[model samples]
Target: MSLQGEPAHVLIVCTGNVCRSPFIERVLAALLPTDAGVVVSSAGTGALVGRPMEPLAAAQTERYAGSPAGFAARQLVPGIVDSADLVLTATRRHRGEVASLHPRALSYAFTLGDFADLVSGVTPEDVAAFGESGAEGARPRIRALVRAVAARRGLNPPLEASQVDIVDPFRGDETRFEAMAQQVMGVLPTVARALVP
Candidate 1:
């Protein structure tokens, strides 16, 4: 998440980038502090690069805080995985893609809901005990949060299906897309509030 005290960077990945990843990325960006300098970006394991978000997902984001005017799908790259502090994949398959590409990333990377489940168990005291490296900006606090969650690797209980993967809604099914959006919207704000100071 950091090198030389830089802001934490998050990379979200899905199958096509045109749907779930873009929607989730924008929502997280909107939830975090702009000044905190948290970098949130999305990509696809097999992305439709240069394509805008799928219509159904775009509509969902519009209902929230994102604008479809500036989104473009992109394929995942090793560099993106290397730079990310937290790599949240839309599915276990996507997470496997990231790990197979970079074994060292296995610790920091997770499925979106998997990450939520892990972080949900981290109490405020755990964050405090991770050490305060001067309480000014969010980078330290965020790093602490990530560290805390990472520490819970084997300690926390396993996750249920609904908390480990977001169903892809790119099949031209608006109803499925809405359900996916609800899942993401419900989880991301809690994550942002925990990591953002």
Candidate 2:
């Protein structure tokens, strides 16, 4: 159920689609402004394909997702990435997979952690220019912010693995999943504000 005639689509990708990607998806869905007309979803490079998120991950999503009914795992494909306005991949390698599917996606796709790091410095002034038209104005503003981040992609030296990625915690115990969710959530607050600010 899309709101806008042409909504901004955010596609998050990971390996198993059970933990990180689904968690991020629900967070974004809950965090983004309702009027902003942004649609967030997740898929996996090697997804479970029609499965639910991990129990621990699903438990965490309730704190942010408003309900437990929204998370579902699916396989990733070029067509899904192709339709996205922004593609936030779980790993650099996943980003590579997205790029391999669509060369132009490079401009729109980013590793989630790297994307968070790249845009961490954005201020209220950066978002203020979008004005107050609600959803009508949020789309261009989001695109502007994305471009602002994309422009800085190569300026920084390459990120070591830790800074650029969140470790996969698919089959791990509750402790590992908690740590991964914390990292993902840490990046969420600032970036989520930028998306709907």
Candidate 3:
């Protein structure tokens, strides 16, 4: 899909737009080619608009890659949902919240992990081909293998289901924030490839 006149827009969602989502947005922007013609932004389904990222998250993010200078948090609104070509949320609950607010987004909305799956075209048959016994057992095996490869290459593994949710790390310590950030960052390049390629 050529992001020509229409820039591919991605909106990352979380609880307060102060932690996971913002970190994902910055990492995506940095990982993607500057001329890739994709516009990346983030919001919180229930955010404290005009606020900065949580102090701990900000500190951790900065420690790894310098401060997210001038970054300001924003609340998720219908307009943001409507404008996004892709909507990635932190969890299944967050996906539901966004969908309830913008039912029109149901098709485009997915957990970041799930979107990764869509891009890779990993179907049930593919899972079965692994011959890992039952479907349930096979799916995780496939996902883990893919995730391992992605991690090695700094890419996002394809998601197995849109329902596969990322755990939120709100009100947690810097360690938690770092863990969440690492997960989000891992998947961002995959998202970027999907949007730009």
Candidate 4:
């Protein structure tokens, strides 16, 4: 089921798109419910256009049950922001960039780590209850869920400065990629539950 007459769209952003964003995109895609028809994609602020995921990051994605096949980086554009129902960026800086690209998107755009943390306290029932009056199905429920999470932004601050950004591991070793993957995977289940529950 879909809201807005189409599948719910989630966009992930990073600097180069070859490491952080692509890996997160694939993992998040795999995590989302297949029947929900959620569309997950990624782009870069300064993309290495046409490049594939960084080898180490791709390996981590595979380790975590995500496929990194045939991926190519694309530069972030305004339309991408406009189409996204939810935008999860690698860092706070990327969140700001998305806001600058589309001011209206600010309400639904968040740093990936920040989103995970904020949504941690939001249970599946809260999301379903939000759209209970009229909106039904996973798509509307997800839309309501994103809005619900966004509403909690000012109420709960991140525990630490580091809890708000996924560190770029593009130029790092396998260890760095592993750490990055851990950070991302740590929060995805919370997001998936809200979106697909």
Top lDDT prediction, candidate number? 4
- Name the lDDT value of residue 193 in candidate 1: 75
Q: Over the stretch 1-197, how does candidate 4's per-residue lDDT look in tens digits?
A: 33344578899999999999999899988987677768999999999999999999899989999999999999999999998889999999999999998999999998888888899888766676666476655557667888888878778855675876887887899889999999888888777766775
Pick the TM-score winner.
4
**Model 4: which ten-residue window has the lowest total lDDT?**
1-10
lDDT tens per residue, model 2, 4-96:
545678899998898889988888788877777788888998999888888888887786663448567889888998888788988999999
C-alpha RMSD for every candidate:
3.1, 3.7, 10.4, 2.2
User: lDDT of each prediction vs. the true structure?
Assistant: 0.83, 0.79, 0.68, 0.85
Estimate, for each residue in 1-197, the C-alpha lDDT of model 3 and write its tens digit: 22344355778898889888887777677766666666678999888889887787777666556357678889898999998767888887888999999998776677787666555554334434533344232223433333332333224544444336655678877678777777766665676664443
Order of all candidates by lDDT, from best down to worst?
A: 4, 1, 2, 3
Full-model lDDT, candidate 3: 0.68
Q: In model 4, how large is the Cα lDDT of residue 87?
A: 95
Across 1-197, the per-residue lDDT of candidate 1 in tens digits comes to 32234677889999989999999888888777667668889999999999999988889988888766689999898888898878888988898999988888888888878788788889888878775656544566666777788888888777876677888788868889889999887777777776665
**What TM-score goes with each of the models?**
0.89, 0.86, 0.72, 0.91
- What value does the lDDT take at residue 51 in candidate 2? 88
Displacement of residue 136 (Cα, Å) in model 3 is 40
